[model samples]
Every structure is written in structure tokens, then in C-alpha cells.
Target: MTITVGEIKYTNAFPFFYYVDRNKLLEKDCHFLIQTPATLNREMKAGRIQVGPISSFAYAENVDEFVLMPNLSVSANGPVGSIFLYTKRPLEELEGSRIALTTTSATSVHLLKILLKQYVEVNVTYDEMDPSFDEMMQDHDGCLLIGDEAIVTSWREEVETYRYDLGELWKEYTGTSMTFAVFAVRKDAIARQRAILEELYTAFVLSKEKNRKEQYASMIRHIQKGMGGTTAFWNHYFSNLVYDFHTQQQKGLLLFYEKAYEEGFLPKPIESIKIWGDVRTHHSSLM
Candidate 1:
């Protein structure tokens, strides 16, 4: 049977999937379906897609049913291009203001709450608003945005904003690389199709290297269009956005889950969840 995969449309997340599709690396029986991050999580939770990359929070939210694959993710140590908090007031002032949240990003919403509670020392009201940053900025003191929207809006001059980089904050608090997203498979899929999944993961790793050199220009072009930035901006952002999946990064993932649980953001302990794939199977020099 063909395996449907859900993924985000942005360049940072698409290169690996694009490599697989462009090379036709999967088995004849397997096929992939690409969708937005939100749609991907919805489909995975509903069991429509067997495997795909998704937000770290989504994986935590549905931890029991999925297995994390090795060697592929969208993450960074200090600055992740996709997730941001834009505010007219400094983050410290958010203590008493109403904040508009971009409902599209589960990870960012939780990150904002976690950071605010830790730093701002007061609870703030959260209301969902249209994903448009302008509209959100008008009615609320600040806005949370992710994916291409954050990238495009970060360069705006009129928004008198103080940017809160969540990835950086995560690193400061945890002292490890933050995992913004990960490639994961359903638990049943891992049990039934372990061999194919392994091959797919290997292919994905090789493809990432290949694309880094052979398709960098195309990737930059895509980012420029999707993110509304110049080639230089895309180049800088892509270079800074680390994609390596390693044990060191896993420490951050585990830490995020651990803290989220302790802070009551997660419903249960992370140890109870089954992460798909064996980390020992893959080794990376980058970590």
C-alpha cells in the first residue's frame, strides 16, 4: 500500500521531502501527500497519514501513537526562522496585555505561554486571531506567528516590534538545541514497515546532503518567494537554520517534553510515550 505523508510547504521543511519525490526513492507501493503543518498533524492524529514531519508539540500531544524517525528535523540553536513573537511592547510588558496568538502554530503558542509565565511573572489573556500579522497587531498588544508568515513579517519596518525568538529562549533555558519539528511515523507503521521506513530515512539523509549542494539555488528561490525575502535573507536564514538530527538535539526535545509536563502544559509524563525508530541505528558526526 502507498504511504501518504504530510508535510509543511516552507523551504526549510520541504527539501528532504522534495528530494524523495524528485528521485522517486520510495517503493512502488508507497506514495506521499504534502500538506500544511496543521493539516499534517490533523491527518496523522486521525490516522490518515502513516508518517511525516510535524511540530514537536504535536508529537508530544499525541506521543503514545507515534514513533520518531532518526536524522531529520527542522531546528536551530539560537534562531529558528519560522517561529516568532512580535510585540509593540517589550516581552516584559506582556504581563498585563492581551496577546493575539496565531492558531496555526501549536509549538509557538505553548512556547509563548511557557516563556511568559517564566519571565513576565503574570498571566496574560490569549485570543485567537487571523494569521495576518497586521490584523493581529491592531487589536492585540502582540502576536505569535510561525512558518513563512513569521519570516516575511520579521523584516517589516512599520511594526515597532520587539522580537522574541523562541528557539533562542529555549536554548537559554535548557542549554541544548531546540527541535522545532521532527519526522515521525505511526507506531503501527513502524511495527509493520520497519525495513521500508529505515530505507526511507537513509534516503532522506542522503537527499539532504545532495540538495544542500545541487539544489541550493532552487531552494533559495523557493524561500525568497514563500517568505517574501531577498536571496541574501533566504541564504542567511537557511545557513543559520540547522537541520541535523543528533542525540545532542534529542536532549533538548526530551527536555522540552519534560518541562512541558512539569509545568502542566503536557497532560502526562513523556516517558510513557513510545518514540518510533531506534536512535542507535543512526550516527551523526555533527552532534
Candidate 2:
């Protein structure tokens, strides 16, 4: 059966997904949908895409309909250079200031809220606006941005602002990796395409291993060409990102869910992550 898969259109996902085309078997069975995490989340929920990396918050919103893929995610231990809050005032000093959040985000928006309210203990108003740094900074004290836009903004020399990497901040607050997005599959689709899913997992792992073995200088050059970052910047960004959803990443995501739940961002508290994998191991993990 042909399975629909959502591919996150960001530099962080390249190591996990870039080499999928090398697997001829998967290329035939998988139909890929490339889009931003927010768009992918909506598509996955609508059943337009059977499996893909989606916003962690979106997974919680439709927890019953989906199960997470094993050993696959978009996460970082510290200083994920792609997500930043460029602020006018110092972070602690912005108690009553206004911040603009990117409307294109799902997980980062809630992550920022959890940090600002539960950790920072700030009483601030947030505006949901388009991801335009110049426009956002004009009217608000800070702007929470993610993906390529955040990276480009950080690289730009002209617009100087105090920038805080959300991943680093999350690590400081929780002492664990921040899992921004996860591979989520429709429960029904999992039952129908179990073999394909397993192969897909193998291919993804192989892709990640290959990426880690070398600098992939050509890929870096391509990224620099399109994104306008220095070769060193792109190299460091890719080298440090964590893509596997092991124990640490899982713990971080669970804590995030807990915080999101307490803040009333989710309808219910998620106790354990439901996963798509070996039945015995999945049950054991839940326990």
C-alpha cells in the first residue's frame, strides 16, 4: 500500500529525511508531503498525510487518533540555533511587555508560553502575528520565531536584538532536550502499513548514520546558498541537532506535555506516549 508521509521543510530535518530517496523501495511505497510543521500538523489531523513529523502540541491535541513513530523526532539538547526570541528588553525585565509569537508555529508557541509563565513568572501579553521579524519587533518587546526565519534573523548583522535560543532556555529550565516535533502516524494507517513503516524506520536511521559520518559539504554549501548563512554556522547547526527519540528526548517531551496541560493548552494530560513499534517494547515503555 502507498503510505502518505509528511516531511518537515526545515534544515533540522535534513539528516533524517534527505537520504530517503536513496532507498528505492521506500521511494516507491511512500508519497511525501513537504510543508511547514504547522501545515503538516493540520494535514496529518485531516488524514491527508498518514505519517510525518508534526508539532508536538498537535500530537497532544489529537492523541487518540495518532501514535508516535519510534526513534524519530526533531529535537535538541541545547542552543538549537533555529528557534529564537529576539527581544528588545532583557528577558527578566519584560514582565508586563508585549511579545509577538509566530502564527506559523504550534510547539514553539506553547513552549514559549510554558517558559514565560511557569519558569519566568512573567505577566505578559502575546500577539499571534505572521513571521515577520521587522514587523513584529516594531510593536512588541519580543518575537518568538522558528525555522529558517529565526536562523536568518540570527545571522543578520543589521537588526541587532538580544536573542535567546529557546532550546537552550528549555534545557536550562528542564535539564533535558527540547523535542519540538515528532513523527506521528495515524493509528489506522499503522495497522495497514506496518511493514512499510518498519522499512521507513530503518531507512531513516541509516540516513542519520550517514549524515553523522561526514560533513556532507555539498549539502552545507546548498544550505548556505539558499539560507545565506556561513559554512561554519550551517555546519554547527546540523552537527548538534538531535533527531532520535530515545529516553532523554521522551522525558523532555513528556514534561513539555505536562506543562502544556497545566497551562490549559491541551484538553487533557497525557501520561505516556503511545508509539508505533514492537508491541512488547511499546507496552514496556508505557509502564
Candidate 3:
């Protein structure tokens, strides 16, 4: 069975996926489609794609339909310099002001809301808009930016603004990492094509391990061209990102879901995150 997989085109994901694409790690039966996080989320929900690295909010929204690909995610412990909130004034000072949330993001937007409500305790209004710094700052007191655009803006020396990394902010508030995205497969796809899905998962894990070398930095910088910032900046950006869904990352993700739920961002709280295949079987046995 040929399975369609979605990949997001972002520097944060370049390390894990760059080698996968360059080496053609996916088997002939696997197909890849590239798009933004929001597009991939919509495609996966609509059954147009079987598996994808979707926003954490997307998974929270449809938990029963998706099983996370074990040991693979995009997370950050602190200061994930990419997902930023460029503001006219300090976060606490933005009370009752309008914030322009990026329409391209689902998770970051929710994280921002959680931060403001749970941590900052500031009353504000939000509206979705295109992620242009100038346009966002023109009318809104702050703007949420994610992926490559956020990274570029974060490193801009000319743009002196209050930059708050949502991941860093989440860490400060919860003292845990923030999981932005995770590779997940539809429940129907896993039930129907278990073997193929296992193969794909194994391939993905192997691809990540194979490219753990420092030399991959040059390749990553090449892929992230025109996103601004120096190679070191890109390297550090990717370095802060974690791909494994270990205990710490899992705790962080669940806390995010909990906070989002308390803030009225999530419709309901998720009990256990479903994992694809027998990846968690041994761990489950120990427990």
C-alpha cells in the first residue's frame, strides 16, 4: 500500500527530514507531500494524507483519529528562537491591546493564549492575520510568528522589538519543554496498513540517527536559504529542537495540552497520547 506522508517546509524540521529527502529514505511505496503545518493538518484531517508532522493542537483536537509516531517530534526545552511574539511593548504591558496571531499556526496561537491568560494575566484581543512584521505591528500591539519567518525576524538587528519565544515562555511558565509538532498517522491507516506503517517508522528513526553528525549543519543552512540570519544562528535554532518523544518531551506536551485546556483553547483534555506500532510496548510492560 502506497502511503502519503506530509512534511512541513521549515528550518526547525530540516535536520530530521533533510537527510531523509536527500537519501530517499522512504520506500518506493511511500510518497511525500510538502506543505506548511496548517495545510498538513487540514490534509490529514480530510484523509488526503495518511501521516504527517502536524501541530500539537491538531492532534489534541482529534486524538482518537491519530496515533503519534513514537520517538519523533519537534520540541524545544527553552528559547526556541523561531516561534516569536514581536511586540511593541512588554508582554505584561500589552493589556487590552490587539495581538495579531499568525493564521498559519494552530499550536503557537494556542500557546500564546495560554501564556497570556495563565502566566501574564493580561486581558487582550486576538485576530488571525498574515505574518508580516510591519503590517502586524502597524495595528496590533504584538504579532505571533512561527517557522522560518519567525526565525528570520528573531535574528534581525534592525527590528528592535520585544521578542518572546513561545517555547521559552512556555518553559518559564511550566518548567518543561514545548512540543510544537509530532509525526502522527491516522488510526484508520495504522489499522489497515500496519506493516507498511512500521516500515516507514523504522525508516524515519534510522534517517534521524544517520544524520546526527555535525557535518549536516552545512546542508541544513543550504536548505534554509533566504530565511536570513547566519549559519550559526540556523545551527543553534536546529540544535535547540528535539526530535525524540521521550519522557521529558511527553511531560511537556501533556502540560501544554492541560494549560491549553484550562485556558479554553482545547475543547477537552487528552488522556493518553496514542503511539503507532509496538514502539511503546516495552515501556508499557515495565509500567
RMSD of each: 3.9, 4.5, 4.4
TM-score-wise, the better of 1 and 3 is: 3
* lDDT (Cα, tens digit) per residue for candidate 2, span 14-76: 777766663465456667888889899999999889877899889999999998878888899
Each candidate structure's TM-score, on Cα atoms with residue i matched to residue i, is 0.87, 0.91, 0.90
- The candidate that wins on TM-score is 2
- Candidate 2: where is the Cα deviation over 4 Å? 22-29, 279-287
Candidate 1, pairs of clashing residues? 67-276, 68-276
Name the better of 2 and 3 by lDDT: 2
Number of clashes found in candidate 2: 0
* Best prediction by lDDT: 2
lDDT of 3: 0.80
TM-score of 3: 0.90
lDDT of 3 by residue, 1-287 (tens): 67798888886776556545422434356678888899899999999899879998899998988889988998999988779988889988988989999888889999998899879999899988887888988888889999988876766679978888888889888899989999989988977777656656666666576556664565666765655466676667667878889989999999889888887777888767887656422111100
Candidate 3, position 168, lDDT: 88
Show the lowest summed lDDT stretch of 10 residues, model 1.
278-287
Whole-model lDDT values for every prediction: 0.74, 0.84, 0.80
Error of 1 at 244 (Å): 2.0
Error of 2 at 240 (Å): 2.2
